[model samples]
Target: MKRLAVSLTLFLVLSLGVGLLVSGSEVLDWGIAGGLFAIAVLGECFRFWIRRTRSKKRDSSSV
Candidate 1:
C-alpha cells in the first residue's frame, strides 16, 4: 500500500513536469524535461540492479 502511494505521487509529479515542458516554448524547458527523464530512468535501473543482486545473494545463502 505504501509503495503504491509513493509510486502514484512520483508519477503525478513527473507528469506535471513533463506537461510543463511540452507546453512551454523555451529551450530550457526541453533541457529540464530531458534531465528529469534521464534521472528517473537511471534511478529505476539502479533499483532493479540492486534488487537483482540481493535476490541472488539470498538464493545462494539458502543452499
Candidate 2:
C-alpha cells in the first residue's frame, strides 16, 4: 500500500513533467501551476504523516 502510494505520486510528477515537454504555447504555464498545487498538497500530507508518526511513537513508548 505504501509502495503504491509512492509510485502513484511519482507517476503524477512524471506525467506533469512530460506534459510540460510535449505541449506548446502556454502549455507549460498551466502545468507549472498544477505542479505547485501538487507540491502544496504533498507538503500538507507529509506534515500530517509526521505528526501521526510522532504520536504513534509516543503512545507506544508510554505503554
Candidate 3:
C-alpha cells in the first residue's frame, strides 16, 4: 500500500515535469518556477529550525 502510494506520487511528479518541458515556451518567462524553488529552500530551512529547537529542548529537559 505504501509502495503504491509512493509510486503514484513519483509518477505524477514525473508527468508534471515532462509536461512542463514540453510546454516550456509557454511558461519559460514566468517566475512561478523560481518561486517554487524558493519555497523548497525555505521549507528545508524551517524543517532544520524545528528539529534544532526540539533537540535543544530535549537536552535541557534531561538536566
Off by over 4 Å in 3: 1-27
Ten contiguous residues minimizing lDDT sum, candidate 1? 24-33
Report each candidate's C-alpha RMSD, comma-separated, in the order given. Answer: 4.6, 5.4, 6.7
Candidate 3 lDDT by residue in tens digits, 2-22: 654565556555545655775
Lowest-sum lDDT 10-residue window in model 2: 24-33
lDDT of 2: 0.69
Q: What's model 2's lDDT at 57?
A: 92
What lDDT score goes with residue 42 in model 2?
78
Ranking the candidates on TM-score from highest down gives 1, 3, 2
For each candidate, give its TM-score against the true structure. Answer: 0.59, 0.52, 0.55
Candidate 1 has an lDDT of 0.69
How well is each residue in 1-63 modelled by candidate 1, as lDDT tens digits? Answer: 566457656865785578586766754465666667667657766877998999999889953
lDDT, candidate 2, 1-63, per-residue tens: 676477657756775776677566655756664765577567767877998999999889853
Residue pairs in clash, model 3: none
TM-score of candidate 1 on Cα atoms, chains taken together: 0.59
Output the lDDT of residue 49, model 1: 90
